[model samples]
Target: MSLVEINFDGIVGPSHNYAGLSLGNIASASHKGDTSYPRAAALQGVAKMRGNLARLGVQGFLLPLPRPNHALAEALAYDGTEDRALRAAPWSASSMWTANAATVSPAPDTRDGKCHLTPANLVTMLHRAQEWPDTKRMLEVAFGNGDHFAVHDIAPVTFGDEGAANHMRFCEGHGTAGVEVFVFGRPGGKFPARQHEQSFRLIARRHGLDPARCVFIEQNPAAIEAGAFHNDVVSVANERVLFTHAEAFADQQGAYDAIRAAFPALEVVEVPSDAVSLEEAIRTYLFNAQLLTLPDGSMALIVPEECRESAAVWKYCEAMMASNGPIREVIPVDVRQSMANGGGPACLRLRVVCDPATVDPRFLLDEAKADLLDQVISEHWPEQIDPADLWSEALTTQVVAARTALLAALAITELD
Candidate 1:
């Protein structure tokens, strides 16, 4: 069976704002209460997707989750008035970073020979905790092929599952069985570890992956303290290549040894501590880049523009590109809006390996669909949204109308 990895990116929502909601996310906190350009943010995300599809020739897209999250306010026993609910509800546009969408086990690894996805419970942060139910609903609609796809519920709340943000898979090819790496964070430092060890184990067991092909590793507390909120902030893997910082994990050597023992051909690319400090890595979001296999059988690093601007990161990337390394080139994408919110190129997407035919047609993207989305974003999305405007009836109407237009264009009736 032929298989390929599709990148499904979440469109930025109309209510995208800087509420400084996430505790561990430095950018979110730093930019709290600042004015946000929701229309520009959505268009920037679309442009990135368009470029990826044009360059890589394969990509997919997911619609933004409904914003203002009035349901959450209602659940909290807030009055049903729109103004009251909007005022009380937390504005969460974090769903644009789809890496936290789910933990996907490809058909080759699962016992049932069907791809499985379990949405992250995301119980650590209140704003994020409200995403799972809507996320699960969207996932079910997008991956509706019952014979080939299995959409599972969110992990138990106590487990604190953060989904693909703390997961990586390595294989010879997308069609083959791969080694799944689950990186959990332990709480003992200044910054709280968002992922729980039990959560990692639970996901592995739930996926039914072979014991020999699964490895669990702990994240380095030092990295977390340096503002690496998610494993993706300091490490990312693609195929057989694992790109990471020197202090990314608690047992760096042990983790490497285990991975090598499982997949002998694995290539471990470690950026030495002296060359790039954890502070620089987090600032440039170097590890948050998308390591992709291009159509020419060579790999490319799709990084945020911030990496190119950082002298240290740019120097390292130039050296890497010059060498005969697995990464043949570096492609910089402008996602400044998302970056300010603590997400980068990799965070914006969820990677799923499958036969394209098995996915729901509405989730897949083409040039025509991209054009339509561009039109929707340009014509209907809000130009700017201040924190104080979150409760405005006019803004709510615009957001709802924009989403309705997008759903219609995508032929996604379930969301409508």
Candidate 2:
């Protein structure tokens, strides 16, 4: 199997806004009711995709979900007199964080000799819970090759499953067999723990993954209380490298021991709490970065521009890189719009390990496709979206049309 890791980034939707619908996300809450720049956000996302394509040699993208999704609004009785949070739920662009799109077990680890995916039943928040149906629809079309891929329906919503954000894979290489880690959180925390243990167990069974090869680890309650809403917020893994915060797991050493036992070659690069507190880590999203293996075989940490600005985070990054660690380079990109809305480089992408040829041509992104995205997003996406604009009929029409234009451009009407 000629497999490689392809990052499918979500195109920042025209209805992108700072609704602060997520309770555990500090950035989203802090920037609530702020003005959002949809055109700039989408353009920034495209630029990031272009950069990754240049480094990784291949890239893919996921289309934005239909926004101002009045289905939920109508079901909830949207009568203009509803609360602002409830009103913004329909227009929330949280779907741009593709890390929460699904949990995937690549072919190398599955019994069927085919990659498997289960869309997340994100039942934790009303805004996010509505994503699975649309997300599953897109996944079906993108990875429709039955011979290479098996995309399964989401597990029951009774147990919250926030998808790949809380999951990590360990392997010698993208094409090799490896251990999969499912990070579940305990209750009685300051915020609701979205990833349930049962949810991932069901996903593993559905994907036909060996029970012994899958490690169910507990996310640090301290980290979650300190605003690390998802595991990606405090840790990220790429192949054999697990770049994480010292307090990322409930039993940090035990968590390491478990994974290292499963895949002994695990190279862990842990950032201590003294070097950078969990609060600083969450605030700067230092761990919520794309830890990518470049074409040269060296690894790079694609972080947000905010990491560069933070004195503590930048200093730690410089020292770590200077130490000649597994993460050879630290690259920063401008994704401040997404950062404010509570996602970063890793959050914007879904990492699928497979041969690019098996994927639908429409979903694959190339230089020309990147150019098209730049043009369409720049031309059709809204320049500004205020909280009040979510209620505006004209803005809804514009948001809907902008996505339609992009779908038409990509010739991907399956999503529309």
Candidate 3:
């Protein structure tokens, strides 16, 4: 099998709205109560995947998990009596940020030589707590070929696990064994530490990873307090390179030393805090960019437009490109809608290294599939979703119909 990395991005959902659900997510909190454009959000996401398909030649997408989750609403017994946040929880489009969907250990890193994925039992907040079962079901369908893939139930709820947003892997190439870093946080603060240390330990064991190759590190407490909710918000790793802000970890040198001990060929592309402060990185999502190994053996950083708009961030990127470093290209894409919802390019995807043929083709994106997505989203997705509109039965029906239409178009009967 020709093993390669496939980024399974989430197609933004029809119920995309700004309910300001995620705590410690500065963007989400700041945009709460603002009207959101669902059609535009989803289209922007598709456009991103299209760019990925062109660059990598193979792009897969995870469909929006069934939303306006009536089961959750019924379980909460939400009869218009609870707080607005509770009422809006059932309709949140947060699932479109697929980084939190699961944590994956590619075939190269696992003992069984079969790629393993664990759906995150996102028990952090009420809005996201109800997502795992549906997320797991969707994953099972996407990676159902038993011979090459294994999707396991999350090992468990108590210790919070926010999935790939907090995890990074390093290796010489995508097809080789790598060091997996599970970044967890120290609790007791204004904002809750989402990825508990215990949770990642559970995930590491669940994936049957070699303990020697797994490095458990602590995210900088200051970064978390500064609204750097996940490690990806402060750092990102791709193949042999680790691109990071200076203050991304509690013990920056220690983190580097640990990684080097396991993989000696590690390349560090450190962005100085003098050029861009921690506050600037978090605000612009400078580190949340996707560091990809392009098809021709060059590396590119897929950053949000906000990075270009910022003088400091852009200057740093320009210097990095001119320095003859591993990162050869700096490409900026417009994911403004997702960025406003506390997700940049990285948050919209879950990366898996595997043979594309082993995946259910319905999850992969081709030109015709792109066109179909544009049409379905344009026709069935709501043009604008006001915070108050989430309560409308008409909007609920539209959201359900839009997802069903997408499932039908893809011939994904399991999700339907």
Cα error of candidate 1 at position 389, Å: 0.6
lDDT of 3 by residue, 69-113 (tens): 999989988998648777899998888988999999999898888
Please provide, for model 1 over 58-105, each residue's C-alpha lDDT reduced to its tens digit, 9 standing for 90 to 100. Answer: 789887888767777777765645553245345678888999999999
Candidate lDDT scores, in order, read 0.87, 0.93, 0.91
Q: What stretches of model 3 exceed 4 Å from their correct place?
A: none
Cα distance off (Å), candidate 2, residue 346 = 0.5
> Could you tell me the TM-score of candidate 1?
0.96
Indicate the residue-level lDDT of 52 in model 3. 88
Runs in model 1 with CA error above 4 Å?
A: 77-89
Mark the 10 consecutive residues where model 2 has the least summed lDDT: 81-90
Q: Ten-residue segment with the worst summed lDDT in candidate 1?
A: 80-89
RMSD of each: 2.1, 0.8, 0.9
TM per prediction: 0.96, 0.99, 0.99
